[model samples]
Target: MAGTSKPAVYKYSRGAQPGTAARTGDWRFLTPNWIYRPSPCRIACPLGSEIPAWLEAVKRERFDEAWRILRRSNPFPAISGAVCFHPCTENCNRGQLDESIAIPELERAVGEWRQKHYRPPAGPPVTRGRVAVIGSGPAGLSCAYYLNRAGIGVTVFERAPVCGGLLALGIPQYRLPRALLSRELEMLKDDGIIFETGVAAGGELPLDRLNEEYDLLFLAVGAQKERPLNIPGAEAAGVISAYEFLRRVNLGETVRLVEPVIVVGGGNAAVDAARVALLQEGITRVSLVYRRTRKEMPATADEVDAAEKEGVQLYFNLSPQALRLEEERPAEILFEQTETAEGKIKVLPAPPRSFACGTLIYALGQQPDWEALGRLSRELTLFAGGDLVSGPSTVPAAIQAGRLAAAGIMERLKRRPGTGEAQFLEGKPVVGFEELNLAALPSAHLTRRLSDPVAEAGRCIGCGTCSSCGLCALYCPDLAVQWRRERYDVNLDYCKGCGLCARECPARALVMKGGWEDAC
Candidate 1:
């Protein structure tokens, strides 16, 4: 009878009773199996800032704690919150549902809130160490902040007429307010970070001397030199470098330009300069000329859109070939129309010409003068992109580089030695983000906050780099998300290589490994 007993055949209809979509194994404890330890968003950030912790503080209105958490990665949250271009938002799990969370706004809120309410305790009088920083840009100011916090005195020297080398002069005020800049500088001063404005740290001021005086020296002199407009007779009276132009305008230069201005190049500088020129000339016909199409233009989309909306004309597929001079005065601007060839835009010979009344502002771009930097280029270090020659150029990138530089300096001092291990970077697999149980995370239906479409112009200038669609946080009925935060701090911890978070993020912001596709 046992042998004859019919082997039961359970039919699995498309919906035949599914086994309780079994609780994904708990790996956080790492008992029977390994648990993923990383917070997805933090993993996405370049600096690995404890995002979840600070964001949790922001959510709970613990502004001071949040500010402190942000300070751990970026000491200049106020500066970054304003202009750093929120890459975190691009990776936000909420972006899939609607728009991404207004991370910059949240950051700005916490930053401003902290600025108003909290204050760092002042350290005792300057002790043994002094860090001489060449510039007061984000890199320099940030380095000074960290060193000063560590009880090491920092003296920042700035060649610029003002304190912020790029932050004060290059960035437009509408984006990053001067008031906010001044406030952050004040905070640094209170924290024992000294700034010597108008002092050049180059040969005149002596870089060698700084190396001799301070225990450490950080060169952050930003790329100040501008690329000359290389058109015929570009040195004609009307041509000007975009850097000096923007700097002057931001510094309250009541600059009055001749009517019908033509701005060469389609970068941030070009857009800002053209828009400002329009504001000064009052709709006197400003044109942004770029050889490449708008897609390839280096200006942030917001910048380009704002310029267009503000009535700046755009001339794509055009490059100025020659600037006609007559009687020692410019007569006309000749441009060669461009056409895409072999996946690259190239200017054609003998092309269309446009007549203009006056000035040409070239924003083609700028770079660090290697000759000017000389051996310091070896020290300050810059790439063709004007970022530090090494590491990522973004805010988080600078954070990562600064941290590594600190480690290198520490090693040189024989404080902590490197392991001599080769850091060969190879991508590996991790958790299932979106595959989690959705019932746990309190109303997964609720969406993340975002910039209002109507108010997009005045606010919402984003760097556009997110993908976060939250499933892992919502699933794991055992409250795994909270546990992850508690154990490894979901802030910026590395994962236990589980696929849960990867499965849960609908945005596919995370990926996993070991041949476990979505099967896990």
Candidate 2:
């Protein structure tokens, strides 16, 4: 008994060898295919930013990692945070639970935090052939940013004295401060992007001449030309296009205005013009006139609300008829009552109502200056994007266009036929409110004031992605699920496909897949 080790008494009976399934038919059922799906927010973004990835990084207190993830797709998060329509929030899966995540505010926080703390070390000189981008707006800047990062030399040409085409000239300072905009633009300068202000490509500089100097030409010339108002008294001294007025104001020129300013149209430009008019010293009682109802207005609801809060009177369903002039300035404007019936605008044939105004600003819309682009050169590789191609879209869309143009240029210059679509594993099903076990989650209504990053990051549900919570491992029926490094993996030999691991997963990141043979 002393030498035999007491026959190693067993406490429990053992089953067939633990890993024996590797050689038998049981392997088919035990094998599982893991997948990673794009969050709804990521799919909605035209820039293809990995929203969930960065959010997870933020939750882990990896602020720099989050910023790096953001920089992978969006070049100007600070600018976008101020101006982007933020379609990502609308598409967020969290909306089904309580409220959509405050994506734009968080993005702004990350951008501001990164700007204050992280400055990328200067990159080496570009060895790839020189690329010329015309226009210093979102599209051109985005294109140049990506190209420069890729070691491609980029020279941005602008006709204005300053950069940021619409960003500098079209947007109001109250919405996007010029100092913040300039600081964001300085990042471009620090990255070694060549700037040729007061130089107009395709016209003053000549596209043919540029072709000899640069290997590629990207025409990002955005739509800055104001769409003319066809109504009477458009040429009146007091009536000015909103684009021109905003441009003059943004460029730091003195705009002498009279009281009772009237802004026409129902777009962001109109709302912006109204707000700016309210801030002017001589202006009082700003009125916004639109033919459509509040619900149909093109401007963002928040912007409209801001304008109203700033004492701008909104007159919906009012169509401009004629402008009465006194001493070559607008004195009064005639309007007609309008209503939408069967999806068509019907102007009622009633006695025209008249409203008096000291000044009039028409914020109708804008179109690209095709003449600036001139005729397309047959001999040169030409790429056009941004508002020039999309016709006055949102800033994010314009940025996306620039990214696409950069990709095209990269493909052409590299002489690659085309890179195939990126391969990705299928993601798990989107987690719904009903599927979530709320007991383990933070309050669905949990949100922070936009300034608080830690509190805001806490509200994230980590939808459709693993938060590495270890709940799956804790609940695995057969001890098949194990944590290694930072991720959980299944030991298929011990797995019986009971699906408890996936069922208990808090983030809905795991899914029970049919075996390889069964899938076939």
Per-residue lDDT tens digits for candidate 1, residues 1-520, read: 3787898887765675544344443233331112323344455666666555566555545677777777777666677778865666677544543455566777777678767875767547666466677777777776666666555667888887788767888888887899888998898887777888877756557766765677666766666778887778888786778888889988888766666788888778788888878878455688888888888887878779989998898888888888877665566787888977666877677547775747778886667756765655344322121154542245446545554554455554444422331122225332223543333333345444444311221121111111122344445344334344232123212224454654554333334444222221
What are the Cα lDDT values of the candidates? 0.62, 0.78
lDDT of 2 by residue, 396-429 (tens): 8888888778878888788332233222234544
- For each candidate in turn, the TM-score is 0.75, 0.88
- Regions of model 2 farther than 4 Å from truth: 1-28, 31-34, 120-123, 375-378, 415-449, 477-485, 491-496, 516-520
The TM-score of predicted model 2 comes to 0.88
